[model samples]
Target: MSSAQNLAEKPKYKRVVLKLSGEVLRCSETGDPISWDTLRKICNQVKEIHQLGVQVCIVIGGGNIFRGLSGSTDQGVDRTTGDYMGMLSTVINGLAFMECLEKMGVQTRVQTSIPMNQVAEPFILRRAIRHLEKNRVVIFVAGTGNPYFSTDTTAALRASEIEAEVIMKATKVDGIYDKDPMKFDDAVRYDKLSYIDALQQRLNILDSTAFSLCMDNEVPILVFSLNDSDSIKRAIVGEDVGTLVS
Candidate 1:
């Protein structure tokens, strides 16, 4: 069936920021950092939503390649230098993601906070908005073009700038749990949460900076598992697939 014909269902949000962790691209069995299969799966889902007429903005992390905080604390690297390495890693992931999406026939653009004219367009607010207006997927990368900040913060910042209706954060688990779901069998998943409640309970749905930014901007966040096939589509189509933080 044609993608247009498949759009019988409408998405809950017209525009959204899809937050992806670089770890999602890892191959567990092979221990490879960038898994083509995983990338393909993710791009396919993005394509699905794009076909549904949702303006997609993606912000991907670089944990799989490198983590600045971990490098600084664990490897004795300078914080600023480590963060710049992490930002470079995000650019690599963004380029790979853009390649995957383009191969899948979805129009995509990568904008980096740090200017890299040879590789991608510099992060320009007007240009990014114009890309979305033209139904192109815009992927923001390079960790806000600075050190001492995270991609989570970048996601929140970009969402606010683009005026995205919500931020869909794909994680390893199904939803936000009161405790570590992997360690605690009694961990309970929340169906929904208010920003104040999330803050009061200290639910680690996002980093403090990112969480506070979302709360301040009133941008809702949907936390869901990326392992499930069609989960993005389910969430976009309003199927209650994850924990919603508003």
Candidate 2:
């Protein structure tokens, strides 16, 4: 088969936004903020799909380093200041991811919503699109360049701006469950969910604002487990790998 034909058979979406939580990079065993082993595995999966010709954009959270809301309530940090600190943390994760991806021979660009001229390019919609068109992975960091917004919202916004076909969220659980699966063995997983149902039920797979943005944009969300070695590749190939929220 021609290379194009082979690639066509593999990816369901031409472009996608991958949302990752910073906690995924944490070393659970050592209490370290970033785990090279975990990062490497995730990057390899990203490389796998990129090789299949999928245009990938990434938005990762900073919860592993700090959470703004929690900092405000728990540590008495001012909300705006706490949020800015959190945003900086995401930039750190983005830089680490960019370095790893480039080392793997995959071209990548780190675009920040906030200007960090020395480390990354300021996000420009046209430039980001051009990078994807040229097959360079683009990692969007710094969370909307404002406080009072979650990384989830940033992912939804970037996905809509880039016209990504889907937002693939790598989570701890394999799919969205009625209850916390880790806590409740009887928790039921939904293979699919409608945005309305998810909202009415108050499912916390994403923040309400993020969910609403995606609903309005009509972009599907795929929630899958990062623990699964091949989950990302399976999702990209349109396999039944996780819960589908539309």
Candidate 3:
């Protein structure tokens, strides 16, 4: 059977939550501001899924602009304060993504966990649902408006709240591996795994809090490489292109 046929045969999830790290927005070589090339690539992928009539919601991270917690120890800033700064960074990313999606002629809305009336609407579950119903891609930012919560956790929370069928985690790595695939050439890539196995092995796939949330809520997560052309489309269409962690 063809790959696309295999993908079409898998069970289809009605709606999904996608989590994107901020670093993916930046240039891989320079690690600078949002790369237009990368943004366009992602936009194309999202557009493909949008065309597929899938209800999509996105949670973007802020490591590219500023990873506050990572720098807190060196800068002597409180962890909470640093985390808030990280949240703000996500807003910036949301705006950037909104602009790109708009340029692509795709309707999008940026909603933040924290209120920013002038910039974006505060996250309201009902309103977000409305947007999705209207075929508008919703971009959720600000990481739950709380310190210490990563975007991954936010993804899980939002997915559960919205009753999404699955959460799609876009990462640098193609799938979840037994070890750091980049460092360990012999690492094994898993096609499917239980949340318990990931936790027991300490796979470093999703953050502990995020993993716990998914486990408790029974929300399946698919980890895949964002750089792969048409990955988001393939994922939304039920393709087995990544590690499925349930």
Q: What is the TM-score of each candidate against the true structure?
A: 0.96, 0.96, 0.93
lDDT scores in order: 0.93, 0.94, 0.89
lDDT of 2 by residue, 76-161 (tens): 99999999999999999999999999999999999999998999999999999999999999999999999999999999999999
Candidate 3 clashing pairs? none
Per-residue lDDT tens digits for candidate 3, residues 1-246, read 898775574547668898999988888787686888898898888877887778889899998888878968878878999999999999999998899999988899999989999999999999999999999999999999999889989999999999999999999889999898899999999999998898889888778898899999999999998878988887777677889998
lDDT of 1 by residue, 106-173 (tens): 99999999998999999999999999999999999998999999999999999999999999999989
Whichever of 2 and 3 has more TM-score, that candidate is 2
- Quickly count the clashes in candidate 1: 0
Could you say which candidate leads in lDDT? 2
RMSD each, Å: 2.0, 2.0, 2.6
Error of 3 at 246 (Å): 1.2
Prediction 3 TM-score vs. true? 0.93
Model 1 lDDT, residue 189, Cα: 92
TM-score for candidate 2, please give it: 0.96
